[model samples]
Target: MSKLKVLGICGSRRDESVNMKLLRYAGSMVAAEGHDFEIFYFDDFPLPLFDSDEEAKTGIPENVHRLKQAVREADAIILASPEYNGSITPLLKNAIDWVSRTSARLQVTDEWKGKPVGLCSCSPGAMAGLRGLYHVRDIMVECGGLVISEQVSVGKAFEAFNEDGNLVDERTSGFLKAMISKLLEVSQALKKA
Candidate 1:
C-alpha cells in the first residue's frame, strides 16, 4: 500500500483541547500504519477573521494560500472540532470560507473538488459532537469534497482519552482505527483511479 499524506486539522483554541488530543491519537495511528500524518491548527496559519472587504482590498492572504497548499498536497484530511451550539467552531468555518473562494485575477478555488475528507468530533455530552460533524460534512460536501461516510465521535471527551492521547475504551479505539483505515483506503483507491 502506498503511504498517504494525511493532514489533520484541529479546530479548537483551548490549550489542552480534546479535539487536538483526538488528532494526536489519529496521527500516531497513521504513523504506525507507515503513512505520514501531520497535525495543524488554524492559528498555525494565523489568518484574521475572514472578511470579504479585506479580501477584495488585499486579495488572498499569504496564510490562506499556504493553507490551501497544505490541503492540495494532502491525500486526505481529518477535521476534528468540538460542537458549539450544535455546529462547527467559527474559526473552522472562517477558514473554509476563505479557502473555498477564488479570485479571477489571482487564481482558482478548485482545490476542494474531488478531495477526500474525514470528520471526527468529541464533546462532554453524550451526543459526542456528532451534531457538529454533520454540519461539517454538509459544508465539505457543498465545497465538493468527497466526505467519507465513516466517521468517529467521542462523548465525554474529557474522560474518553488518557494523557497519552489514547482512547480509554477499546471499542471506541477500534472505531477510530476503522475510520482512519477507511480514509487511507479510499484515498489510495482514488489516487490509483
Candidate 2:
C-alpha cells in the first residue's frame, strides 16, 4: 500500500493525436484508483535520433536525462502508441533507444529494469495498432522491463471515442482497466519483494 507512481507515455506528437487521448484517458483512470499518474508526451521532450558519437562527446541530451529520470522515479509505465506501417512509431522507438543507452553518470541501464509496464494503442485501421505492440513489448523486455500480459488496442480509433473523448466501447474500456490493474498489482508485489 505505498502510493504507486505510474507514468503514461504517448508516442504521437501531433496536436490532436488519438493515441495521446488514449493515454490521457488511461492516466485519468489510474489517478481515480488513488495512485499518482503522470502523462509524458514525446512532443514535450523531443530528442535527436540516437547517436553513439554524440552521446560519447556530449553525453545524454538534457531531454533524455529528464525522461530517464521520470522513468526511474515511476513504479510502472503505460505506453500508448499508434501503429505506423505495422510497427511502432519512430518517435516512440527513438525515445526508447535514447533511454536504453548506458548513462555514464548512473553507470547502469536501470531506468526500465524490472519495472512493470502496460501496453495499449489506438489506430483507425482494423489492426488497431496491435502489431506495433508486439515490437514495443519486445523492446521493453530487452530493456529489462516486466511487461503485463493484458493489453488494449482500440481499433477504428477515429470512431472509438465519444464526443466527451471517452472510450465508446465497454469491452475496450474493460480491457484497458484490467491491464492497468494488473500493472499496479504486479508493481506493488515487486516493490514489496
**What TM-score against the true fold does each predicted structure earn?**
0.96, 0.96
> Candidate 2: what lDDT?
0.89
Give all candidates' CA lDDT scores. Answer: 0.87, 0.89
RMSD of 2: 1.3
Question: After TM-score superposition, what is the CA distance of residue 53 in candidate 2 from its true location, in Å?
Answer: 1.0
lDDT of 2 by residue, 48-136 (tens): 99878887888778898889899999999999999899998999999888877776674646588888999999999999999999999
User: How many angstroms is residue 64 displaced in model 2 relative to the true structure, after the best TM-score fit?
Assistant: 0.4
TM-score of 1: 0.96
Candidate 1 weakest ten by summed lDDT: 39-48
